[model samples]
Target: MDYRDVDIVNHQRGWDGYFKLDVYELRHKQFNGRQSPVIRREVLERGHAVAVLPYDPVRDEVVLIEQFRPATLSVHKNTPDMPAWLIEIVAGIVEPGETLPDVARRETMEESGCSIIGDLELITPRYYASPGCTSETVQIFYGRVDSKNAGGLHGLAEEGEDIRVFTKSSDDCFAMLRDGIFCNAPIIMAMQWLMLHRDRLRREAASTAI
Candidate 1:
Protein backbone atom coordinates (compact mmCIF):
# COMPACT_ATOMS: atom_id res chain seq x y z
CA MET A 1 0.00 0.00 0.00
CA ASP A 2 1.15 3.54 -0.79
CA TYR A 3 0.91 6.22 1.89
CA ARG A 4 1.73 9.87 2.51
CA ASP A 5 2.32 11.62 5.84
CA VAL A 6 1.20 15.23 6.35
CA ASP A 7 2.38 17.57 9.09
CA ILE A 8 0.77 20.92 9.82
CA VAL A 9 3.18 23.82 9.65
CA ASN A 10 1.25 27.06 10.28
CA HIS A 11 -2.43 27.88 10.15
CA GLN A 12 -5.01 30.65 10.32
CA ARG A 13 -8.75 30.76 9.89
CA GLY A 14 -9.88 32.53 6.72
CA TRP A 15 -12.42 35.34 6.36
CA ASP A 16 -14.74 32.95 4.58
CA GLY A 17 -14.82 30.93 7.83
CA TYR A 18 -12.61 28.27 6.25
CA PHE A 19 -9.36 27.26 7.87
CA LYS A 20 -6.24 27.70 5.74
CA LEU A 21 -2.91 26.17 6.64
CA ASP A 22 0.53 25.32 5.41
CA VAL A 23 1.63 21.70 5.49
CA TYR A 24 4.86 19.75 5.07
CA GLU A 25 4.58 16.20 3.79
CA LEU A 26 6.69 13.30 2.66
CA ARG A 27 5.62 11.18 -0.32
CA HIS A 28 6.70 7.73 0.63
CA LYS A 29 6.22 4.96 -1.91
CA GLN A 30 8.05 2.30 -3.91
CA PHE A 31 7.60 2.48 -7.64
CA ASN A 32 8.39 -0.49 -9.89
CA GLY A 33 10.59 -2.20 -7.29
CA ARG A 34 12.64 0.99 -6.97
CA GLN A 35 12.77 3.13 -3.82
CA SER A 36 11.63 6.68 -4.54
CA PRO A 37 12.08 9.69 -2.28
CA VAL A 38 10.06 12.71 -3.33
CA ILE A 39 10.04 16.10 -1.59
CA ARG A 40 6.53 17.61 -1.61
CA ARG A 41 5.40 21.16 -0.86
CA GLU A 42 1.83 21.97 0.03
CA VAL A 43 -0.77 23.05 2.60
CA LEU A 44 -3.99 21.28 3.52
CA GLU A 45 -6.67 21.27 6.17
CA ARG A 46 -9.43 19.13 7.70
CA GLY A 47 -12.01 17.95 5.18
CA HIS A 48 -15.77 18.56 4.94
CA ALA A 49 -18.17 15.57 4.65
CA VAL A 50 -20.13 12.99 2.72
CA ALA A 51 -23.51 12.95 0.92
CA VAL A 52 -26.29 10.37 0.54
CA LEU A 53 -27.68 8.61 -2.55
CA PRO A 54 -31.18 7.41 -1.68
CA TYR A 55 -32.67 4.58 -3.73
CA ASP A 56 -36.29 3.43 -3.59
CA PRO A 57 -36.45 0.20 -5.56
CA VAL A 58 -40.16 -0.35 -4.97
CA ARG A 59 -41.12 2.78 -6.93
CA ASP A 60 -38.61 1.98 -9.66
CA GLU A 61 -37.25 5.50 -9.18
CA VAL A 62 -34.65 7.53 -7.31
CA VAL A 63 -35.05 10.56 -5.06
CA LEU A 64 -33.21 13.72 -6.10
CA ILE A 65 -33.32 17.26 -4.80
CA GLU A 66 -33.08 20.50 -6.72
CA GLN A 67 -31.62 23.42 -4.78
CA PHE A 68 -29.91 26.73 -5.40
CA ARG A 69 -26.17 26.89 -4.83
CA PRO A 70 -24.44 30.24 -5.29
CA ALA A 71 -20.95 28.77 -5.15
CA THR A 72 -21.53 26.73 -8.28
CA LEU A 73 -23.06 29.71 -10.10
CA SER A 74 -20.00 31.83 -9.26
CA VAL A 75 -17.76 29.38 -11.10
CA HIS A 76 -19.69 29.45 -14.34
CA LYS A 77 -17.69 30.95 -17.24
CA ASN A 78 -20.22 30.84 -19.99
CA THR A 79 -23.17 33.15 -20.70
CA PRO A 80 -24.30 32.48 -17.13
CA ASP A 81 -27.82 31.63 -18.18
CA MET A 82 -27.53 28.54 -16.06
CA PRO A 83 -29.83 28.42 -13.05
CA ALA A 84 -28.32 28.53 -9.59
CA TRP A 85 -30.24 25.36 -8.84
CA LEU A 86 -28.50 21.96 -8.84
CA ILE A 87 -30.02 18.50 -8.55
CA GLU A 88 -28.46 16.33 -5.90
CA ILE A 89 -29.08 13.36 -3.63
CA VAL A 90 -29.89 14.31 -0.02
CA ALA A 91 -26.77 15.43 1.88
CA GLY A 92 -25.43 17.30 4.90
CA ILE A 93 -22.28 17.57 7.00
CA VAL A 94 -22.06 14.99 9.76
CA GLU A 95 -22.87 16.95 12.89
CA PRO A 96 -20.73 16.66 15.97
CA GLY A 97 -21.78 13.71 18.23
CA GLU A 98 -23.78 12.26 15.35
CA THR A 99 -22.93 8.98 13.65
CA LEU A 100 -22.82 8.56 9.86
CA PRO A 101 -26.08 6.64 9.66
CA ASP A 102 -27.78 9.22 11.82
CA VAL A 103 -26.56 12.01 9.56
CA ALA A 104 -27.90 10.16 6.55
CA ARG A 105 -31.32 9.75 8.12
CA ARG A 106 -31.45 13.31 9.42
CA GLU A 107 -30.46 14.75 6.08
CA THR A 108 -33.05 12.62 4.31
CA MET A 109 -35.81 14.01 6.50
CA GLU A 110 -34.59 17.58 6.46
CA GLU A 111 -33.91 17.81 2.77
CA SER A 112 -36.61 15.64 1.22
CA GLY A 113 -39.19 14.78 3.87
CA CYS A 114 -38.55 11.09 3.29
CA SER A 115 -37.71 8.43 5.82
CA ILE A 116 -35.09 5.82 5.12
CA ILE A 117 -35.14 2.37 6.74
CA GLY A 118 -32.49 -0.24 7.58
CA ASP A 119 -28.70 -0.31 7.55
CA LEU A 120 -26.78 1.98 5.24
CA GLU A 121 -24.42 0.40 2.77
CA LEU A 122 -21.13 2.20 2.35
CA ILE A 123 -20.28 3.10 -1.20
CA THR A 124 -17.12 5.20 -1.28
CA PRO A 125 -15.26 7.87 0.66
CA ARG A 126 -13.05 10.27 -1.30
CA TYR A 127 -10.54 12.65 0.23
CA TYR A 128 -10.53 16.28 -0.88
CA ALA A 129 -13.66 16.63 -2.94
CA SER A 130 -11.42 19.30 -4.44
CA PRO A 131 -7.99 18.85 -2.83
CA GLY A 132 -6.47 21.92 -4.44
CA CYS A 133 -7.77 24.31 -1.79
CA THR A 134 -10.38 22.76 0.50
CA SER A 135 -9.80 20.02 3.03
CA GLU A 136 -13.12 18.35 2.42
CA THR A 137 -13.59 14.62 1.94
CA VAL A 138 -16.95 13.03 1.29
CA GLN A 139 -18.29 9.57 2.10
CA ILE A 140 -21.13 8.17 0.03
CA PHE A 141 -23.92 5.84 1.13
CA TYR A 142 -26.92 4.03 -0.31
CA GLY A 143 -29.96 3.85 1.97
CA ARG A 144 -33.10 1.84 1.37
CA VAL A 145 -36.26 3.97 1.09
CA ASP A 146 -39.99 3.34 0.65
CA SER A 147 -41.02 4.60 -2.77
CA LYS A 148 -44.76 4.10 -2.48
CA ASN A 149 -45.40 7.05 -0.18
CA ALA A 150 -42.45 9.13 -1.37
CA GLY A 151 -43.76 12.64 -1.91
CA GLY A 152 -42.65 15.85 -3.60
CA LEU A 153 -40.08 18.47 -2.47
CA HIS A 154 -40.25 19.11 1.26
CA GLY A 155 -37.32 20.91 2.90
CA LEU A 156 -36.44 23.06 5.88
CA ALA A 157 -36.91 26.65 4.83
CA GLU A 158 -35.21 27.84 7.99
CA GLU A 159 -31.97 26.31 6.75
CA GLY A 160 -32.32 28.15 3.43
CA GLU A 161 -33.09 24.86 1.79
CA ASP A 162 -35.78 24.77 -0.90
CA ILE A 163 -35.46 21.33 -2.38
CA ARG A 164 -37.69 19.91 -5.11
CA VAL A 165 -37.90 16.19 -5.08
CA PHE A 166 -37.98 14.16 -8.26
CA THR A 167 -38.77 10.51 -8.78
CA LYS A 168 -37.14 9.65 -12.05
CA SER A 169 -37.06 6.50 -14.09
CA SER A 170 -33.74 4.80 -14.76
CA ASP A 171 -33.90 5.45 -18.49
CA ASP A 172 -34.62 9.17 -18.06
CA CYS A 173 -31.86 9.39 -15.50
CA PHE A 174 -29.39 7.82 -17.91
CA ALA A 175 -30.41 10.39 -20.50
CA MET A 176 -29.77 13.15 -17.97
CA LEU A 177 -26.41 11.56 -17.25
CA ARG A 178 -25.52 11.68 -20.93
CA ASP A 179 -26.55 15.34 -21.11
CA GLY A 180 -24.41 16.24 -18.09
CA ILE A 181 -27.36 17.13 -15.89
CA PHE A 182 -25.82 15.89 -12.67
CA CYS A 183 -22.62 17.40 -11.27
CA ASN A 184 -22.55 15.62 -7.94
CA ALA A 185 -20.28 12.54 -8.01
CA PRO A 186 -22.25 10.49 -5.50
CA ILE A 187 -25.45 10.85 -7.49
CA ILE A 188 -23.69 9.74 -10.66
CA MET A 189 -22.19 6.72 -8.92
CA ALA A 190 -25.54 5.82 -7.40
CA MET A 191 -27.24 6.00 -10.77
CA GLN A 192 -24.58 3.77 -12.23
CA TRP A 193 -25.12 1.27 -9.43
CA LEU A 194 -28.87 1.44 -10.02
CA MET A 195 -28.40 0.75 -13.71
CA LEU A 196 -26.56 -2.41 -12.77
CA HIS A 197 -28.49 -3.58 -9.69
CA ARG A 198 -32.06 -2.31 -10.06
CA ASP A 199 -33.57 -5.72 -10.63
CA ARG A 200 -31.96 -7.35 -7.63
CA LEU A 201 -32.78 -4.40 -5.43
CA ARG A 202 -36.43 -4.51 -6.50
CA ARG A 203 -36.68 -8.18 -5.69
CA GLU A 204 -35.09 -7.70 -2.31
CA ALA A 205 -37.38 -4.80 -1.47
CA ALA A 206 -40.45 -6.88 -2.34
CA SER A 207 -39.43 -9.62 0.10
CA THR A 208 -38.06 -7.34 2.82
CA ALA A 209 -40.07 -5.93 5.71
CA ILE A 210 -41.08 -2.26 5.80
Candidate 2:
Protein backbone atom coordinates (compact mmCIF):
# COMPACT_ATOMS: atom_id res chain seq x y z
CA MET A 1 0.00 0.00 0.00
CA ASP A 2 1.06 3.58 -0.54
CA TYR A 3 1.77 6.15 2.17
CA ARG A 4 -1.72 7.52 1.72
CA ASP A 5 -3.10 4.24 2.93
CA VAL A 6 -1.49 4.76 6.31
CA ASP A 7 -3.29 6.95 8.82
CA ILE A 8 -1.49 9.02 11.38
CA VAL A 9 -3.74 9.18 14.40
CA ASN A 10 -1.63 11.41 16.59
CA HIS A 11 1.80 12.98 16.23
CA GLN A 12 3.33 14.96 19.10
CA ARG A 13 6.75 16.01 20.21
CA GLY A 14 8.25 13.63 22.74
CA TRP A 15 11.66 15.23 23.20
CA ASP A 16 13.37 18.42 22.07
CA GLY A 17 17.13 18.54 21.94
CA TYR A 18 20.00 18.38 19.45
CA PHE A 19 17.91 15.57 18.03
CA LYS A 20 14.13 15.42 18.30
CA LEU A 21 11.75 12.57 19.00
CA ASP A 22 8.21 12.40 17.71
CA VAL A 23 5.67 10.06 19.15
CA TYR A 24 3.40 8.49 16.57
CA GLU A 25 0.17 6.60 17.00
CA LEU A 26 -1.01 5.33 13.68
CA ARG A 27 -2.48 2.51 11.62
CA HIS A 28 -1.77 1.33 8.14
CA LYS A 29 -3.38 -0.92 5.54
CA GLN A 30 -2.14 -4.43 6.19
CA PHE A 31 -1.10 -6.94 3.52
CA ASN A 32 -4.53 -8.48 3.72
CA GLY A 33 -6.07 -5.19 2.53
CA ARG A 34 -7.47 -4.45 5.96
CA GLN A 35 -6.88 -1.71 8.50
CA SER A 36 -4.57 -2.63 11.39
CA PRO A 37 -4.81 -1.70 15.01
CA VAL A 38 -3.21 1.54 16.13
CA ILE A 39 0.42 1.20 17.13
CA ARG A 40 2.72 3.59 18.97
CA ARG A 41 6.09 4.39 17.49
CA GLU A 42 8.67 6.94 18.58
CA VAL A 43 10.67 8.21 15.58
CA LEU A 44 13.82 10.27 15.86
CA GLU A 45 13.48 13.49 13.90
CA ARG A 46 17.05 13.87 12.68
CA GLY A 47 16.11 15.27 9.28
CA HIS A 48 18.47 14.75 6.29
CA ALA A 49 22.26 14.50 6.07
CA VAL A 50 25.11 14.29 3.55
CA ALA A 51 28.36 12.30 3.29
CA VAL A 52 31.19 12.61 0.77
CA LEU A 53 34.17 10.36 0.12
CA PRO A 54 37.18 12.40 -0.95
CA TYR A 55 39.25 10.52 -3.51
CA ASP A 56 42.49 11.68 -5.11
CA PRO A 57 42.62 10.21 -8.58
CA VAL A 58 46.22 11.09 -9.43
CA ARG A 59 47.56 9.84 -6.11
CA ASP A 60 45.03 7.00 -5.93
CA GLU A 61 44.28 7.79 -2.32
CA VAL A 62 41.38 8.74 -0.06
CA VAL A 63 40.90 11.13 2.85
CA LEU A 64 39.52 9.45 5.97
CA ILE A 65 38.61 10.75 9.40
CA GLU A 66 38.01 9.49 12.92
CA GLN A 67 35.91 10.99 15.70
CA PHE A 68 34.41 9.96 18.99
CA ARG A 69 30.74 9.08 18.99
CA PRO A 70 28.93 8.81 22.29
CA ALA A 71 26.20 6.66 20.82
CA THR A 72 28.53 3.67 20.84
CA LEU A 73 29.99 4.34 24.27
CA SER A 74 28.23 1.43 25.93
CA VAL A 75 29.30 -1.07 23.31
CA HIS A 76 32.81 0.35 23.24
CA LYS A 77 33.11 0.09 27.01
CA ASN A 78 31.60 -3.37 27.34
CA THR A 79 32.86 -5.01 24.14
CA PRO A 80 36.59 -5.04 23.77
CA ASP A 81 36.34 -5.22 20.01
CA MET A 82 34.20 -2.11 19.67
CA PRO A 83 36.01 1.20 19.21
CA ALA A 84 34.69 4.44 20.65
CA TRP A 85 36.20 6.42 17.84
CA LEU A 86 34.80 5.24 14.53
CA ILE A 87 36.58 5.48 11.20
CA GLU A 88 34.19 7.38 8.98
CA ILE A 89 33.92 9.37 5.80
CA VAL A 90 32.93 13.05 6.01
CA ALA A 91 29.33 13.38 7.14
CA GLY A 92 27.06 16.02 8.71
CA ILE A 93 23.45 16.85 9.17
CA VAL A 94 21.80 19.16 6.65
CA GLU A 95 21.03 22.59 8.01
CA PRO A 96 18.14 24.83 7.00
CA GLY A 97 18.39 26.25 3.43
CA GLU A 98 21.48 24.20 2.56
CA THR A 99 21.44 21.72 -0.33
CA LEU A 100 22.77 18.19 -0.16
CA PRO A 101 25.88 19.03 -2.17
CA ASP A 102 26.55 22.07 0.00
CA VAL A 103 26.58 20.04 3.20
CA ALA A 104 28.83 17.40 1.62
CA ARG A 105 31.54 19.88 0.71
CA ARG A 106 31.20 21.80 3.97
CA GLU A 107 31.55 18.68 6.09
CA THR A 108 34.51 17.56 4.00
CA MET A 109 36.38 20.73 4.91
CA GLU A 110 35.26 20.86 8.51
CA GLU A 111 36.06 17.24 9.27
CA SER A 112 39.12 16.60 7.06
CA GLY A 113 40.51 19.98 5.94
CA CYS A 114 39.89 18.89 2.37
CA SER A 115 37.77 20.67 -0.17
CA ILE A 116 36.01 18.94 -3.01
CA ILE A 117 37.85 19.94 -6.18
CA GLY A 118 35.72 18.76 -9.08
CA ASP A 119 32.23 17.50 -9.66
CA LEU A 120 30.72 15.30 -6.99
CA GLU A 121 29.78 11.85 -8.24
CA LEU A 122 26.48 11.02 -6.62
CA ILE A 123 26.98 7.61 -5.08
CA THR A 124 23.58 7.06 -3.53
CA PRO A 125 20.48 9.18 -3.79
CA ARG A 126 19.34 8.12 -0.37
CA TYR A 127 21.22 6.01 2.16
CA TYR A 128 18.82 5.46 4.98
CA ALA A 129 21.06 5.33 8.04
CA SER A 130 18.44 3.54 10.11
CA PRO A 131 14.98 3.24 8.67
CA GLY A 132 13.45 1.51 11.69
CA CYS A 133 13.48 4.54 14.00
CA THR A 134 15.05 7.64 12.55
CA SER A 135 13.75 9.75 9.69
CA GLU A 136 17.36 10.63 8.84
CA THR A 137 18.43 10.10 5.25
CA VAL A 138 21.87 10.66 3.77
CA GLN A 139 22.90 11.57 0.25
CA ILE A 140 26.34 10.11 -0.42
CA PHE A 141 28.93 11.29 -2.94
CA TYR A 142 32.53 10.72 -4.01
CA GLY A 143 34.30 13.93 -4.94
CA ARG A 144 37.69 14.61 -6.47
CA VAL A 145 40.21 16.08 -4.02
CA ASP A 146 43.90 16.69 -3.43
CA SER A 147 44.96 14.68 -0.42
CA LYS A 148 48.61 15.76 -0.42
CA ASN A 149 47.97 18.29 2.38
CA ALA A 150 44.77 16.90 3.82
CA GLY A 151 45.77 15.84 7.28
CA GLY A 152 45.31 17.38 10.74
CA LEU A 153 42.86 17.81 13.58
CA HIS A 154 39.60 19.54 12.59
CA GLY A 155 36.00 20.14 13.61
CA LEU A 156 34.31 23.00 15.45
CA ALA A 157 35.29 23.63 19.03
CA GLU A 158 31.82 24.69 20.05
CA GLU A 159 30.42 21.47 18.70
CA GLY A 160 32.92 19.52 20.80
CA GLU A 161 34.24 17.66 17.76
CA ASP A 162 37.87 16.56 17.72
CA ILE A 163 38.23 14.91 14.34
CA ARG A 164 41.48 13.29 13.28
CA VAL A 165 42.08 13.36 9.56
CA PHE A 166 44.38 11.16 7.51
CA THR A 167 44.80 9.71 4.05
CA LYS A 168 45.13 6.13 2.89
CA SER A 169 45.97 4.78 -0.51
CA SER A 170 43.11 3.24 -2.37
CA ASP A 171 44.77 -0.15 -2.08
CA ASP A 172 45.20 0.15 1.67
CA CYS A 173 41.62 1.27 2.01
CA PHE A 174 40.43 -1.81 0.17
CA ALA A 175 42.55 -4.03 2.40
CA MET A 176 41.11 -2.41 5.50
CA LEU A 177 37.62 -2.87 4.14
CA ARG A 178 38.32 -6.53 3.55
CA ASP A 179 39.52 -6.77 7.16
CA GLY A 180 36.13 -5.41 8.26
CA ILE A 181 37.64 -2.43 10.01
CA PHE A 182 34.85 -0.10 8.97
CA CYS A 183 31.40 -0.65 10.43
CA ASN A 184 29.64 2.45 9.10
CA ALA A 185 27.34 2.28 6.10
CA PRO A 186 28.53 5.36 4.17
CA ILE A 187 32.14 4.21 4.11
CA ILE A 188 31.14 0.68 3.14
CA MET A 189 29.03 1.95 0.23
CA ALA A 190 31.65 4.40 -0.98
CA MET A 191 34.53 1.95 -0.67
CA GLN A 192 32.61 -0.77 -2.49
CA TRP A 193 31.85 1.62 -5.36
CA LEU A 194 35.51 2.63 -5.53
CA MET A 195 36.52 -1.01 -5.56
CA LEU A 196 34.27 -1.54 -8.59
CA HIS A 197 35.32 1.62 -10.49
CA ARG A 198 38.91 2.44 -9.50
CA ASP A 199 40.44 1.45 -12.82
CA ARG A 200 37.90 3.36 -14.89
CA LEU A 201 38.33 6.49 -12.78
CA ARG A 202 42.10 6.34 -13.07
CA ARG A 203 41.86 6.05 -16.83
CA GLU A 204 39.56 9.05 -17.06
CA ALA A 205 41.76 11.19 -14.82
CA ALA A 206 44.91 10.29 -16.74
CA SER A 207 43.28 11.20 -20.03
CA THR A 208 42.11 14.53 -18.68
CA ALA A 209 45.63 15.44 -17.50
CA ILE A 210 47.32 14.44 -20.75
Candidate 3:
Protein backbone atom coordinates (compact mmCIF):
# COMPACT_ATOMS: atom_id res chain seq x y z
CA MET A 1 0.00 0.00 0.00
CA ASP A 2 2.98 2.29 -0.39
CA TYR A 3 2.11 5.34 -2.46
CA ARG A 4 5.75 5.78 -3.40
CA ASP A 5 6.02 2.48 -5.19
CA VAL A 6 6.91 2.65 -8.88
CA ASP A 7 6.64 -0.11 -11.48
CA ILE A 8 9.07 -0.08 -14.35
CA VAL A 9 7.60 -1.31 -17.60
CA ASN A 10 10.74 -1.07 -19.70
CA HIS A 11 14.28 0.26 -19.24
CA GLN A 12 16.37 1.15 -22.26
CA ARG A 13 19.91 2.47 -22.65
CA GLY A 14 20.56 5.51 -24.77
CA TRP A 15 23.82 7.34 -25.59
CA ASP A 16 26.90 5.70 -24.09
CA GLY A 17 29.27 8.60 -23.56
CA TYR A 18 30.89 10.26 -20.59
CA PHE A 19 27.36 10.36 -19.28
CA LYS A 20 25.04 7.46 -20.07
CA LEU A 21 21.36 8.12 -20.61
CA ASP A 22 18.73 5.71 -19.33
CA VAL A 23 15.17 5.78 -20.54
CA TYR A 24 12.48 4.30 -18.31
CA GLU A 25 8.82 3.58 -18.96
CA LEU A 26 7.17 3.45 -15.60
CA ARG A 27 3.95 3.83 -13.60
CA HIS A 28 3.57 5.01 -10.03
CA LYS A 29 1.03 4.32 -7.34
CA GLN A 30 -1.32 7.24 -6.77
CA PHE A 31 -2.52 8.43 -3.40
CA ASN A 32 -6.00 7.18 -4.22
CA GLY A 33 -4.75 3.57 -4.36
CA ARG A 34 -4.67 3.50 -8.12
CA GLN A 35 -1.93 3.29 -10.72
CA SER A 36 -1.19 6.40 -12.79
CA PRO A 37 -0.61 6.53 -16.52
CA VAL A 38 2.70 5.33 -17.89
CA ILE A 39 5.48 7.93 -17.74
CA ARG A 40 8.62 7.86 -19.80
CA ARG A 41 11.67 9.53 -18.27
CA GLU A 42 15.22 9.88 -19.46
CA VAL A 43 17.86 9.90 -16.75
CA LEU A 44 21.51 10.81 -17.13
CA GLU A 45 23.88 8.58 -15.20
CA ARG A 46 27.17 10.39 -14.54
CA GLY A 47 27.97 8.68 -11.25
CA HIS A 48 28.34 10.40 -7.87
CA ALA A 49 30.97 13.00 -6.94
CA VAL A 50 32.62 14.67 -3.94
CA ALA A 51 33.17 18.41 -3.41
CA VAL A 52 35.62 19.83 -0.88
CA LEU A 53 36.02 23.36 0.41
CA PRO A 54 39.59 23.79 1.56
CA TYR A 55 39.55 26.18 4.48
CA ASP A 56 42.59 27.43 6.33
CA PRO A 57 41.43 28.26 9.81
CA VAL A 58 44.65 30.03 10.78
CA ARG A 59 44.52 32.30 7.74
CA ASP A 60 40.77 32.82 7.65
CA GLU A 61 40.87 31.92 3.99
CA VAL A 62 39.49 29.25 1.66
CA VAL A 63 40.98 27.73 -1.46
CA LEU A 64 38.96 28.15 -4.65
CA ILE A 65 39.49 26.97 -8.18
CA GLU A 66 38.58 28.30 -11.61
CA GLN A 67 38.10 26.37 -14.83
CA PHE A 68 36.48 26.60 -18.20
CA ARG A 69 33.23 24.71 -18.63
CA PRO A 70 32.02 23.99 -22.12
CA ALA A 71 28.45 23.60 -20.98
CA THR A 72 28.65 26.87 -19.14
CA LEU A 73 30.28 28.51 -22.10
CA SER A 74 27.38 27.49 -24.29
CA VAL A 75 24.98 29.09 -21.87
CA HIS A 76 26.88 32.39 -21.73
CA LYS A 77 28.24 32.61 -25.23
CA ASN A 78 25.52 35.02 -26.30
CA THR A 79 25.84 37.07 -23.11
CA PRO A 80 28.93 39.27 -23.32
CA ASP A 81 29.05 39.98 -19.61
CA MET A 82 29.14 36.35 -18.51
CA PRO A 83 32.42 34.49 -18.78
CA ALA A 84 32.83 30.84 -19.61
CA TRP A 85 35.41 30.27 -16.89
CA LEU A 86 33.80 29.51 -13.54
CA ILE A 87 35.01 29.72 -9.98
CA GLU A 88 34.30 26.67 -7.83
CA ILE A 89 35.46 24.65 -4.89
CA VAL A 90 37.42 21.44 -5.40
CA ALA A 91 35.36 18.52 -6.65
CA GLY A 92 35.66 15.24 -8.57
CA ILE A 93 33.79 12.07 -9.41
CA VAL A 94 33.83 9.47 -6.64
CA GLU A 95 35.62 6.36 -7.80
CA PRO A 96 34.11 2.93 -7.19
CA GLY A 97 36.53 1.80 -4.47
CA GLU A 98 37.41 5.18 -2.96
CA THR A 99 35.63 6.66 0.02
CA LEU A 100 34.20 10.19 0.02
CA PRO A 101 37.03 11.66 2.12
CA ASP A 102 39.61 9.87 0.03
CA VAL A 103 38.36 11.45 -3.17
CA ALA A 104 37.94 14.81 -1.50
CA ARG A 105 41.53 14.98 -0.33
CA ARG A 106 42.86 13.57 -3.58
CA GLU A 107 40.95 16.05 -5.66
CA THR A 108 42.00 18.87 -3.36
CA MET A 109 45.65 18.00 -3.83
CA GLU A 110 45.30 17.39 -7.57
CA GLU A 111 43.41 20.61 -8.22
CA SER A 112 44.72 23.02 -5.57
CA GLY A 113 48.29 21.91 -4.76
CA CYS A 114 47.40 21.96 -1.10
CA SER A 115 47.48 19.15 1.44
CA ILE A 116 44.60 18.76 3.85
CA ILE A 117 45.95 19.37 7.36
CA GLY A 118 43.13 18.26 9.61
CA ASP A 119 40.32 15.76 9.17
CA LEU A 120 37.73 16.24 6.50
CA GLU A 121 34.50 17.70 7.88
CA LEU A 122 31.26 16.67 6.23
CA ILE A 123 29.66 19.94 5.16
CA THR A 124 26.24 18.35 4.87
CA PRO A 125 24.44 15.28 3.72
CA ARG A 126 24.74 14.12 0.12
CA TYR A 127 22.62 16.06 -2.39
CA TYR A 128 21.29 15.47 -5.86
CA ALA A 129 22.76 17.60 -8.65
CA SER A 130 19.62 17.16 -10.71
CA PRO A 131 17.02 14.65 -9.61
CA GLY A 132 14.69 15.16 -12.54
CA CYS A 133 17.12 14.21 -15.30
CA THR A 134 20.16 12.75 -13.59
CA SER A 135 21.13 10.16 -11.02
CA GLU A 136 24.15 12.20 -9.91
CA THR A 137 24.53 12.81 -6.19
CA VAL A 138 27.28 14.99 -4.65
CA GLN A 139 28.83 14.88 -1.19
CA ILE A 140 30.51 18.08 -0.10
CA PHE A 141 33.19 18.35 2.63
CA TYR A 142 35.27 20.92 4.52
CA GLY A 143 38.95 20.08 4.53
CA ARG A 144 41.21 22.09 6.82
CA VAL A 145 44.33 23.16 5.02
CA ASP A 146 47.24 25.65 5.13
CA SER A 147 46.75 27.91 2.13
CA LYS A 148 50.03 29.82 2.29
CA ASN A 149 51.33 28.13 -0.85
CA ALA A 150 48.08 26.84 -2.38
CA GLY A 151 48.02 28.63 -5.71
CA GLY A 152 49.10 27.45 -9.19
CA LEU A 153 47.90 25.49 -12.21
CA HIS A 154 46.65 21.94 -11.67
CA GLY A 155 44.35 19.23 -13.00
CA LEU A 156 44.91 16.09 -15.06
CA ALA A 157 45.62 16.58 -18.74
CA GLU A 158 43.84 13.42 -19.68
CA GLU A 159 40.66 14.64 -18.03
CA GLY A 160 40.84 17.95 -19.88
CA GLU A 161 40.79 19.75 -16.55
CA ASP A 162 42.87 22.92 -16.48
CA ILE A 163 42.20 24.30 -13.03
CA ARG A 164 43.51 27.54 -11.57
CA VAL A 165 43.65 27.50 -7.80
CA PHE A 166 43.54 30.55 -5.57
CA THR A 167 42.91 31.40 -1.94
CA LYS A 168 40.53 34.11 -0.73
CA SER A 169 39.53 35.32 2.69
CA SER A 170 36.41 33.79 4.23
CA ASP A 171 34.81 37.22 4.14
CA ASP A 172 35.45 37.52 0.42
CA CYS A 173 34.07 34.05 -0.12
CA PHE A 174 30.97 35.01 1.81
CA ALA A 175 30.61 38.16 -0.27
CA MET A 176 30.88 36.12 -3.45
CA LEU A 177 28.19 33.83 -2.12
CA ARG A 178 25.96 36.80 -1.36
CA ASP A 179 26.58 38.39 -4.74
CA GLY A 180 25.70 35.25 -6.65
CA ILE A 181 29.14 35.01 -8.26
CA PHE A 182 29.16 31.25 -8.03
CA CYS A 183 26.85 29.44 -10.42
CA ASN A 184 27.12 25.98 -8.86
CA ALA A 185 25.11 24.70 -5.93
CA PRO A 186 27.81 22.86 -3.97
CA ILE A 187 30.05 25.89 -3.39
CA ILE A 188 27.16 28.07 -2.33
CA MET A 189 25.94 25.36 0.03
CA ALA A 190 29.42 24.80 1.43
CA MET A 191 29.95 28.52 1.93
CA GLN A 192 26.64 28.78 3.74
CA TRP A 193 27.59 25.84 5.95
CA LEU A 194 30.96 27.42 6.64
CA MET A 195 29.34 30.70 7.59
CA LEU A 196 27.39 28.84 10.26
CA HIS A 197 30.36 26.82 11.62
CA ARG A 198 33.33 29.09 10.87
CA ASP A 199 33.64 30.59 14.32
CA ARG A 200 33.87 27.13 15.86
CA LEU A 201 36.59 26.09 13.42
CA ARG A 202 38.60 29.27 14.00
CA ARG A 203 38.13 29.03 17.74
CA GLU A 204 39.35 25.46 17.72
CA ALA A 205 42.40 26.54 15.78
CA ALA A 206 43.00 29.48 18.13
CA SER A 207 42.72 27.23 21.20
CA THR A 208 45.23 24.84 19.72
CA ALA A 209 47.79 27.65 19.57
CA ILE A 210 47.70 28.11 23.37
Off by over 4 Å in 3: 1-4, 77-82
lDDT of 1 by residue, 96-188 (tens): 888888888999888777788788877776546777765667888888776666667677778777788877776788889888888777778
Error of 2 at 195 (Å): 0.2
RMSD of every candidate to native, in Å, equals 4.0, 1.2, 1.8
Candidate 2 matches the true fold with a TM-score of: 0.96
Candidate 3: residue 113 Cα off by (Å):
0.9
- Candidate 2 lDDT, 1-210, residue by residue in tens: 699998999999999999999999999999998999999999999999898999999999999999988888777677779778999999999999998888988988888888888788988888678989999999899989989998989999999999999999999999999999998899999999999988988898899994
* TM-score for each predicted model, relative to the true structure: 0.78, 0.96, 0.93
Judge candidate 3 at residue 10 and give its lDDT: 99
Residues 8-99, candidate 3, lDDT per residue (tens digit)? 99999988988899999999988898888999999999899999999999999999999997876667768766768889999999888999
Q: Count the backbone clashes (under 3 Å) in each candidate.
A: 2, 0, 0
How much RMSD separates candidate 3 from the native structure? 1.8
- Candidate 2 clash pair list: none
Tell how far residue 48 is off in model 1, in angstroms: 3.0
Better of 2 and 3 by lDDT: 2
Off by over 4 Å in 1: 1-8, 16-47, 79-83
